[model samples]
Target: MSDNVSDGVSSFADLGLGPELLNALSGLGYEEPTPIQREAIPPLLEGRDLIGQAATGTGKTAAFALPLLQGLSSDEGRTGPAALILVPTRELAVQVSQAFHRYGRGLGVRVVPIYGGQPIGWQMKALERGVDVVVATPGRALDHIGRGTLRPQEIKAVVLDEADEMLDMGFAEDIEEILRETPDDRRTVLFSATLPPRIKGLTGRYLRDPVQIQIGREEAPPGEAPLVRQNAYVVARAHKPAALGRLLDVEAPTAAIVFCRTREEVDQLTETLNGRGYRAEALHGGMSQDQRDRVMGRLRGGTAELLIATDVAARGLDVEQLTHVVNYNVPSAPESYVHRIGRVGRAGREGVAITLAEPREHRMLKTIERVTKQRITVEKVPTVADLRARRLELTRAALQESLMEDDLSRFLAVVEPLTEEFDVMEVALAAVKMAYESSGAAADEEEIPQIAPKAADREGRDRRGAGARRDRRGGTPAQGMTRLFIGLGRSAAVRPQDLVGAIAGESKLSGRDIGAIEIADRFSLVEVPESAAEQVIKALRRTTIKGRKPTIRRERDTTGRRPR
Candidate 1:
């Protein structure tokens, strides 16, 4: 039994919350309930189970945490936690626990975070002292359950935060086992950024008579900037590094995350950005837990301005100062793009989502736009002129600030000597030039070739059409390249973008490097450099194309001849 409720309430008091919780919210400066909070808190306070479909920054934590706090009881006989919240990562577990502490301060709710990468004995000591709430990762929670350190019989409410992420991380069985240990009548709540089929299945099996609430991006009133300003730049593959640096110069983000497809890309891009005078840190599965913690610490402490990470490594991370999300390449899936962008534009703060797309990936940008239903404004890569002008503007701003706030008496001696030798205006100009040069002037700028919008669309059409004809007649492969036959084609709803996205996303090649693509009714043929043919074949074999692993091999000669 599930119901979808839609209504609006103006304030926390309007939602029937107690004074302690309401005061805590007010102290935290929470102005009003976000849509998810307004929709979820009432039913949750009434002790109804819920399924909340909201992104990371939409106040979902408080939506669930507030209700749990409202229902807190002081039953001395209860030996186990009154509520259990399961999160996907240790970082999120700590964050959720902190939220609970902040909201439940007046109520004296004892909350402890249990997760791996921390000594189990410390967590055991906390549990032994008794707690009202336990926030943990699924694996650690199960370990406690197995050791009898965690007693679930008294839990009145259970929360599976980021439920979809847990499933993706292979925690389904553990979640189920932990839930089975809890009382069946407990209030079960599930929150996810996405409601995939697996999540739906988990909900059906666990949550009872849940109230389903779905919240999308908030709509800013007409004539206002949207929460996230999405923009994409189409440029040639060779010039992407320069284009990205130029755009960053113009945007001047306080903190940003550049998402890459693989660990290698993350590492390489991190190095490149750092060399270009940006404070960057790389995060991927290849890093140890300690290394990851240090990187995160640096970012949170405002020491690192940029994080270059793969999708998997960046999931469930919420950074307070993140003002921009950069897609090093367009994500292969629209869902991924949504998740990546959702990290910013949080709590009414404006954020930006920028993408650097090669001309060949222009179509993927359109596909993403259509799916997310948000227009990605296609703009020219910032020119070298734009970069220089932005740098100068920054320098002027810095000088203006120093003039207004700094003690300039010490520099007066040098300026007085210069003014005596030259005109005042010329001395001033010389001083400005020195300041600007010291402030990291642009080095050896070059103009990046720009793509006309219509030209890119035409290029896509031309390549798809010509490649299909070339493959049908067994035409010679492009210079230094060979064609590989893929089993699924137009009939499988495969498009040129799909083939290109799969190859570029799964393998080391960029979309621009993947040559002509030919899609027939039953199969497809794509051209790759002769040297990369075997590598692409193995990479494709290991991954799925159009949700199926198609037969991938070199296209035969017109005479049905085999390779020597």
Candidate 2:
């Protein structure tokens, strides 16, 4: 059973949720509690602290969020924060805030995300106007404390999300300082993937008689579908998008999610995928709830087969027959890699988890492998020939199934006439080929322009040891293409330096040759000589800086305007 499934699932109503929220969860398409939620919510609603060992996309936000929202509603007189959620990055902060906003829409609640890289004045104003909940990254929350624009004295509940991550990023002191600033009586919830000494130490110092929820491997399964095959492909970053496209061509999932690290990447990859002929959607923090819903609806109904999203945006998503989960970029943390892969390989069904790592990222990949204790086998992205072979296999399987189940007597007359003009075996082969190629060429294929890999790890092996060899052996020179406006923008809080550094370090270019830099709070525009655009893009797959590996392409005209 997938850990996502609640044990014998309980009704949300039975969980003792108020009517408004019960209706909201149902309307939002949530049917039951995930394991963490079932165990965590009741105590949290009663105002107890919690320490959750959960991963992203496991529905842990709602486990804490529901009770937090409920407690706030029960105390309508409190103008100050009733709950505070601490996340690791600006992307997560926004995503958590949005979840609260959606669930509390009827409560007239205010949930604001406070993070750095955005104007502090805006956050200061939001805090002053008053908020019931504040979802903030630690550094910015600490910044607010130093600036004296926020008060934690009235805070009743404080939840630490991805706690292990905050500590790993060296925020233990800051987290401690923030916790100390809050009222001593406040309910403290600490959620971490692993209870390292740091987490245990912090929990001892902070939480008082809290509930401990551990999600183990023998974890219960939920009401999840059963046909998806789960496997992970380890490839270098530069080839991720192309690798993903190749995988799509190979598996041809009716619906799948290719998880990226940012909204900008979501948009950029969505465009790349659409150009490749798949109906793709982009889901991320910048999109409104209505937009998110519509995207989900399309995916569930099969109107869109590919969904490109950041890990934050794609949370709590459940789509039927979701055949693949491609990590267009490897996650920054090991836990994130688990969560991304966990999305696919649910229930006893098979699923695929594909990670595009750069050469330098081999260490991170190894780290993820060590933590999960799961091998992510390195494999070449399927060349066109492999795709053809896989397609032919599918074609053969379909034909065999049809022969076993469907009556073919009616088609014998047609076959008899065709055999009159050609050898009977040749006629049968031709008919089969025509039927199979309807899905496009699945046999006897040629080489494709191989995307380059970021070869940082193979220091002494054959120059063709990994990403480099893949690039040298496969890719043709790309020309006549100017850098394109990739949808991954500043709204996800991306920066020019992050982009430049990523492109330079990942690709053939030294940091000096990359051109102009433009950044918006939502998006960014970078300039590179038109000739090397594709290779530069290929190189960026290996550059995993800023914890976000996004797509780089030619800029669109609408985004060319600079923010004054």
Candidate 3:
């Protein structure tokens, strides 16, 4: 298989796939092959052992799946699964099994996904009845092999999807055991995001004279921009919820996945977003398998527009309509960042990756930028004025789409009578007003405060100053108290009692823990124990002080000023 053959091939049909597979591809609306698919399909079809370096959402599943299906026997005499795919997570097993079913539907392919969450009895029955393909996680697959249920010797081809992830998750011994059960002559294919040394060693042991294919990261050509629009917003932790709401209003993604760090955060953020009028769902390891399935169904069915999930829970999710990936906080690692954003900008579709970073985490964002070799532009959170403009723009776009696609003949009579009685412009204005109101546009919202980016040296100095202060006090400053700035003050009829009551009522903090409170006309400053700042901010956002949600954040002072 040569590059010329891969490049010259345009469609699945041209790759020498059978009519059944090609027909299925057509029904799925797959017109052409992705870069990975284009490069990896040819060698695979020739019964060659292949090592492919590709990321998720690169169409690698189908690249190998199509060839495997094409080589399978549709006859009834085939006693067991001829193809086996090993994935790191149950979610991925299900997804890959579904793909095999879709592509081999015309040929009556019997595919089963075997994982721990599902009933073993069901899997046992399916295996007894016979299957052409089995997509499974390493642990469950090893269990079946041990129970004499799944016969690896019957498999003619094997695929290790996300091999690197499986290795990282401590599946090396399990994988080795499972492979040992399979025939030595079986055609093996492995796909990994990175070619780590462990992966190379696995290939060396299992693959013989393999065709190594490396799909480089998709980079923007010189003088051109990348496909995924990456951007970050620096926001105080207190104001992040409001800032997210504002950005969502402006971006208005058709579907999005918002990644959180913990199950509690997922639940909290989902509740907060729902209260703000978003159709949001929460997913985490705490939920049952059935619960996770229903949440996924809602997201896929378009009933939910936002999915708030922890990183572990969202692995192997593939949603075609997903337009955005929102990071509630900066990812802990550069690889994590890569995987998060890889869920979007798929199949050459435009996508956006938004990160809400606190001032202290700005350096982590830069580190991710360097490692990924991509630029993430720092953007300002949309203000109230920007939100209004965005809402109006959305309204305008809605009207334009309606004018082009909708049948408005039935309403013409009403408009005609109104135009006859008054001017046509007045009639139009009334109609536009009605449309705007029905669009769920917010009638009023206060401006979200913005923070200036700290200089490099200033940030370093701040960290050192905090450490020194901790040393001098024999503990943290103010006995580990952090001062927070509230956007409301005396001008809004706000008082120290009002602030104290609000904080106490919403957050876990009591009035005793609250330190000095200073009231100013434009803004107010209050001191709270450092550990409770996040909880207080989240609670206050859910409630209102003086009948309004004021911007709240930890106070950052470049000038030398001690807390009162």
- Each candidate structure's TM-score, on Cα atoms with residue i matched to residue i, is 0.76, 0.55, 0.71
lDDT of 1 by residue, 322-349 (tens): 8789998989878788889999878766
**Candidates 1 and 3 compared by TM-score, better number:** 1
Provide the lDDT at 547 for model 2. Answer: 76
Question: Regarding TM-score, does 1 or 2 come out ahead?
Answer: 1
In candidate 2, position 187 carries an lDDT of: 94
Q: Which 10 successive residues of model 3 have the least lDDT summed?
A: 467-476
Best by TM-score: 1
Kindly report which residue stretches of model 1 are placed more than 4 angstroms away from their true locations once superposed. 1-8, 74-76, 399-426, 455-564
Local error of candidate 2 at residue 270 (angstroms): 11
| lDDT tens per residue, model 3, 21-97 | 88899999999988788888888888899999876778899989998888884445778889899998888998899
Q: What is candidate 3's CA lDDT for residue 389?
A: 65
Give each prediction's root-mean-square deviation over alpha carbons: 20.8, 18.9, 18.7
lDDT winner between 1 and 2, please give it: 1
What does candidate 1 score on TM? 0.76
